[model samples]
Target: MRPKIYLYGDSITEESFGDGGWGASLSHHFSRTVDVVLRGYSGYNTRWALKVAERIFPPVESGGVPPLAVTVFFGANDACLPDRYSAFQNVPLHEYKQNLHSIISFFKKRWPEIVILLITPPPIDEDARLRHPYIENPSGLPERTNEAAGAYAQACISVAKECGCPVVDLWIKMQECPDWKQAYLSDGLHLTQAGNRIVFEEVVKKLKEQGISVENLPVDLPLIANIDPQDPLKAFQDY
Candidate 1:
């Protein structure tokens, strides 16, 4: 069976398979070698992720194969202001860190050999949030702030270090651009096509570091190059 890579997170991850999305890019890059599974939950925070962890990531059977790798990307919603309309998604800083640790532990316990990667939340753009607010912006203010998001991003990094897992510091990386607010982020919170590319590149780099790259993995079946023009049927016979 082809090995699998799981993308587990919130809306950012949930929309990662759309046009010009990072997940789609990964799928294309690793085509014929591995299966990239999408298990993102829209509007979910770390707190909610913990609640639904078991249901989404069930244990592997005694003899079943576990996923080759998993990416945990959350914290955008968790950084929402406690007093804002999106307060329902706000998880305190301390709890947010603990929740991330727990999530990693859950995956490690189930798949001892799995390569877990943590992705920090992208930076926020308050002006964009005001320009394109959610349908129910009761407070008429940005529910999230870049500063708050940065704090959560730091927490995510700390958790990754504590658990000895690789991490994608998206928050800091995205801000390296001068116009990140408009170029990288679609809304104040979500990612744009350019932003998705950044994610795809970073993820590929991290996976490669852990020895899970396309070049390292075997293709599922015989390559076309191996088939002879006069005896193409011979190639699949032995497969």
Candidate 2:
């Protein structure tokens, strides 16, 4: 059976299978070698994800192939300002950190050999958020801010180090580009194709560091190139 790679997070992850999305890129990158499973919930926070973690990834004893790796990508919603329209999604920073610790612990308990890759929330563009408000904002303020997202990103990285897991510090990586607000983010929060590409590259690079590269993983079945046209059934005989 092909080893699986799980993507667990909120809206960013929910949209990760869309055209030019990072998740789709990973699927293509590891084609036939692994299954990239997504467990994403739009508009969810760590608190909510923690609540549903077991449901999404039940104990391996429950009868499913355990994943080789899991990417935890969340925090955008959790950084929303308490006074904003999206305040309902906001989780206090300390609690957010705790939730991440718990989430990682849950996965470790369920799959002791699992490789966890933590992804920090990408930086936001307040100007773009104002232009693309989720609702008409009478206050004319963006529900989220780059500073808040940075804080969350830091918290995420801290958690990864504490838990001894690999991490993709996306917020810092994206900002390394001079025009990241326009090049990487679509609506200040969601990612553009360029942004997705950055994520794809970073994820592949990080996974490679953990010795989970495509070159290291075996293809699930015989290569079609090796099949004889006259005896195609030979491939299936052993399959």
Candidate 3:
């Protein structure tokens, strides 16, 4: 069976298979080599994800092949400012940190061989948020802010360090770009094509750093040109 890579998180991840999305890019890049599984639940926080993680990703010890890699991307919803947004979705900073640590620890203890990557929440664009029809506030403010998201991102970074896991620091990296508000994020909270590209490239870079070579991955099947028309079975058997 082909190796699997799981992308687990919230809305950003749920839409990651859409046009110009990072998940789609990864799928294309790893074609015939690995299965990129999307385990995204839109609008979910770490608290919600932790409750369902076991059901979604069974312990590797239970059987079958464990995923080659798994990315834990949360914090976006958890970073929601309680005073502005629904309290149901808001997770305290301390709890957010704890949840991330628990999630990473669970995976590490369950699947020691699997590579884990923790992704920091990307920065939010207040201007874009205010312009969004559904996100308009009476005070002309956004429910989330870059500053708030940055705090969660730092928490994620801290968790990564504590767990000895690699991380994709999206919050910091996105801001480094020129006019990142327009260039990276589409709706202040979500990623655009360029943003997805950045994510895909970063993921590839991380995998390389972990000694996982995409170029060296074996294709799912033998090349058609290598098949013998007169002896199809021979080619199949050889492969």
Candidate 4:
């Protein structure tokens, strides 16, 4: 069976395989070598994610084939302010940390051989988010702020360290790019084309550091160039 890479998170992950999305890039990178499965739910915070974790990622023993790696990306919605417009999605900082730990522990207990990569929420662009047409408060600022998201990002990093998992510090790395506000994020939360590339690169880098050799994974089938048109049966004869 082909190895699988599972992506679990919120809208950012839900849309990760969209046009120019990071997940899509990863899929293309692995191609026939791995199955990139996305389990992202829009607008979900870590609190909600924890409740549904088992439903989405069941024990490996109960499944057909175990995943090679799983990425737990959350915190954007958790960073929502506990105010009128965003309270519905708001999760306390302490709870957010706990939720992350629970998610890591769940996967570790179920599949100890699986590699877990934690991704922190990217920085928010309040100005762009406020200008977005669907923003909660058209006349006011956005429900999420850069500072608030940064706090959660830090917590995510801390969780990774405690859990001994690899991490993609999207929040910190994206900011290192020049004019990241315009280049990385779309509106305030989601990633743009450039942002997606950054995420894809970082994810691969982290996986590599953890001794997961993506480049060396076996291809799913023989190369087209190696197939002989004269003897198509020759390809299947071995099987």
Number of the predicted model whose TM-score against the real structure is largest: 1
Q: Which ranges in model 3 have alpha carbons more than 4 Å from their true place?
A: 60-63, 133-136, 225-233
Tell me the deviation in Å of residue 144 in model 3. 0.4
- Alpha-carbon shift of residue 156 in model 2 (angstroms): 0.6
Candidate 4 C-alpha lDDT tens digits along 1-239: 78899999999889998898989999998888889999999999998999898898766564477789999999999998898377799998999999999989899888888999999999999988887735458448678889999999999999999989888889999999779999998787788899989989999888888776657788777778878999877877767
68-162 per-residue lDDT for model 1 (tens digits): 99999999999999998888999999999999999999998988999999999999999889888776675678989999999999999999999
Off by over 4 Å in 4: 61-63, 133-135, 228-232
TM-score, each model?
A: 0.97, 0.95, 0.92, 0.93
Q: Residue 14 in model 4: shift from native, Å?
A: 0.5
As a TM-score, model 4 comes out at 0.93
Model 2 scores a C-alpha lDDT of 0.93
lDDT of 4: 0.88
Model 3: per-residue Cα lDDT over 1-239, one tens digit each? 78889999998999999999999998999888899999999989999999999899976554567789998999989988898844568899999999998888778877888999889999999888878724437766678888999999999999899888999999999999978999998888899999999899999899879976667778788767877888878867745
Better of 1 and 2 by TM-score: 1
User: Could you tell me which 10 consecutive residues in candidate 4 have the lowest summed lDDT?
Assistant: 132-141
Return the clash pairs for model 1, or none. none
